[model samples]
Target: MTSARRTAVAAGVLFLITEVSAIAGLALYQPALTDAGYLGGAGADGRVLLGGLCELVLVAAVIGTAVTLYPVIRRRHESLALAHVAGRILEAALIAVGIVSVLSLVTLRQDGAAAGADEGALVAVGQVLVAVHDWTFLLGPSVVLGVNSLVLAYLVYRSELAPRPIAVLGLVGGPLVTASAVAVLFGLYGPAAHAISALPVFAWEVSFAVYLIAKGFKVFPVADRTVTAGGMRPELSVA
Candidate 1:
C-alpha cells in the first residue's frame, strides 16, 4: 500500500482504539463492576474515579483519531466520500463522554446525600440536579453511541478497507444500536435491555478493533480512473 493509504489506515486504527476503549473501559467493564454494587462506601467514589480515568483515555483516543486521520482526510478529500461520517462518529464519541460525566455528577450527589455529607443550600440544589442528570444521562449516551456506531459502520462499508464481513458487522451494528437507544428512551432499563442492545455494539466494536490491528491498511484500486482524469473526475491517487 502507498504512504497515504497507510496513513489513512493508521488514523482509522487509532480511531478504532478509542472506540474499543470507550466500549470496553467505560461501557462494558466498568459498568459491570459498578452495577454489581460491590464497592461499598468507596464504591461510589472509587467507581467515579475509575470511570473518569477511563473517560480520559477515551478523550485521548478521540483526539488521536482526529489528528491522525486529518491529514489523510485532507489529502484524499475527493475520494474519502465519508469525511463527514468520521465527524459524526466523533461527535457521538464526545456526546457519549459528556453523558458519562453528567451521570457521574448526578450519582455523586446521591452518594453524598446518602453519606450525610450534604451541606446546606448546596446540598439541596445538588439533589435536584442529581435527578435531572440521572435520567438524562441514562438515555443520552446510549443514543449517542448507537447513532455513531451506525455512522462508523457506514464509513467502514463505504471505505471498503476492511473485510466485507467486518463491514457487514458494522452495518448490522446500526440497527442494534438504534433499537437499544429507543428501548432506553421508552423507559426500558435493567439487564435485559442492556444486554440485548449492548452485546451487538460490543461485538461490532471488538470486530473493528481486530480488523484495524490485524489489517492496519489495505490499498484497493479504484475503478474509473479514466473518468477521474477529467477535471470533474475524482482523484484516486494513494500516498
Candidate 2:
C-alpha cells in the first residue's frame, strides 16, 4: 500500500478502536455511577480501574484518528483540517479530565471506606465526580464531535476522499448531535437524548471506517493534481 492508503487504513482502525473502547469504558463505569457505595466496595475497584484504562485507550485512539488523517485532508482544506486536529485533541483532553475525576472518586471511596468516614459525604463526593464526567461527555462527544464531524464531512464531500453518501451522513448527523446536546444542557430532555443524537454520527464513523479500510479513497482532483494512494501528483489513476 502507498503511504496515503496506509495512513487511511490506520485512521480507520483507530476510529473503530475509539468507538469500541469508549463504549466498553462507559459500560464498565456504569456500575459505579449507579451504585452509591461502589467506591467503598472492594469488588468494584477492579472494574473501576479497568474502566479508567479503557478510557485512556479511547483517548489515545481519538487523537490518533485526527493525526493520521491530517496530512491527507489538509491538502483539500488547510484550515478545516487543522480544526479537526485541534478539536479531537481538545476532546481527548476533556476525556482525560473526566478520567481523572472518576479515578479520584475511586480513591476517595477506598480511603473513606477504610477510615470509617461518613457514608453520606463519600456519596456526595462521588456524585460530584460523576457530574464532572457528565459535563465532559456533553462537551466532548456531543458538542465538539458535532463541530468536528461537520468540518470533516465538508472536507470529504468537497475532496471526494470518501463517498458522497458518507459525507452526507456527517453533515446531517453533526447538527443533530449538537442540537441534542444543547437540549440536554437546557433541560429540554434528559441524557437519553445522547443516544438518539449519537446514532447518525456513530453510523457515519463506522461506515466511513469500513469504506476507508476496504476501498480506500476515491480518485478525485485537487487543484491541478489528482489525489491517490501515492499522494497528490500531477496525474494519477485510482489505486
Candidate 3:
C-alpha cells in the first residue's frame, strides 16, 4: 500500500465516521429536540450530553476528510483543494457552534429546573437554541457541503482520481442540494424537499468513500508523465 493509497483509505474511513456520527447524534438528540418538556424531564441530561459528544466526533471527522484529501487532490488544482479544506473547516466550526448552543440549553435546563424558574422561559430558550442548531445545519451541511462537493467532484473528474460515475454523482448532487437549500431558505419548500435534495449528495459521499477504501484510485497518463488518478507522479503515487 503506497502512502497516497493509505491516505485515501484514511479519508474514506473518516467519511464513514462523519456519516455515522451525524446520524447517531441526530438520533440521540431527537427526544430533546422534539419534546417541549425535555429540559425538565428525567434523563434528559444524559441524552443531551451524549448527543453533544457525538456531534463533537462528527466535527472532527468532517475536518479529517478534508485534511486527508488535500494532498492528493491539490495536485490537480491547488486553489480548489484549499477551498475544499476551508469549506470543511467552516462546516466544522458551524457544527461546533451548534453544539455549544445545545450544551448551553442543557445547562439552562439544569439550572432552571433546580431554581424552580419559569418553565415557559426555559422552553423559550430551548427553542432558540434548537433554532440556532437548525440554521447551522442548513448553512453547514446544505450550503457549505454543496460548494465543497462541487470542488472535490471537479478535481476527481478532471484527474480521474476515482471513477467518473462517482464524480458525476457529486456534480449532479451538489447543485441539487444547493438549490434545495435555497428553496428552504425562501420558504418555498419544507423538510421533505430538503430531504429529497440531500439524497444525491449523500449517495455521492457514501459511494465515493466505499470506492476509495476498496479500490484506492485509478491511474492516468498526463503529458510526458504517468500519474495516479489523483494527479500524483507515478513514483510518488501508490495504490
- Against the true structure, what is each candidate's TM-score? 0.63, 0.91, 0.90
Best by lDDT: 2
Per-residue lDDT tens digits of candidate 1, residues 83-176?
5446445654554555464455546556655777635643455445444444433444455556656655565565555676776775776667
Candidates' lDDT values, in order? 0.54, 0.86, 0.85
lDDT of 3 by residue, 1-239 (tens): 87867987898899999889998888888767788778878637788789999999999999999999887777777788899999999999999988888788878877888999898888888899999988988888888888889988988898888899999999999988988898898999897879889988999999999998998877531333565778865333333
lDDT (C-alpha) at residue 197 in model 2: 82
Q: What is the C-alpha RMSD of each candidate to the true structure, in Å?
A: 5.5, 4.4, 4.4
Model 3 bad stretches (over 4 Å)? 220-239
Counting clashing residue pairs in each candidate, in order, gives 1, 0, 0
Error of 1 at 14 (Å): 3.2
**What lDDT would candidate 2 get against the real structure?**
0.86
The 10 consecutive residues of candidate 3 with the worst lDDT sum are: 219-228
List model 2 lDDT by residue over 1-239, tens digit each: 87777877898899899889999999998867777658667648788889999999999999999998887787777888999999999989999988998888778887888899987888888899999999998899889988888899888898888989999999999988988998999999898767888999999999999898988777543445767898987642234
Give candidate 1 misplaced runs (Cα > 4 Å). Answer: 1-16, 23-47, 66-141, 188-191, 220-232, 237-239
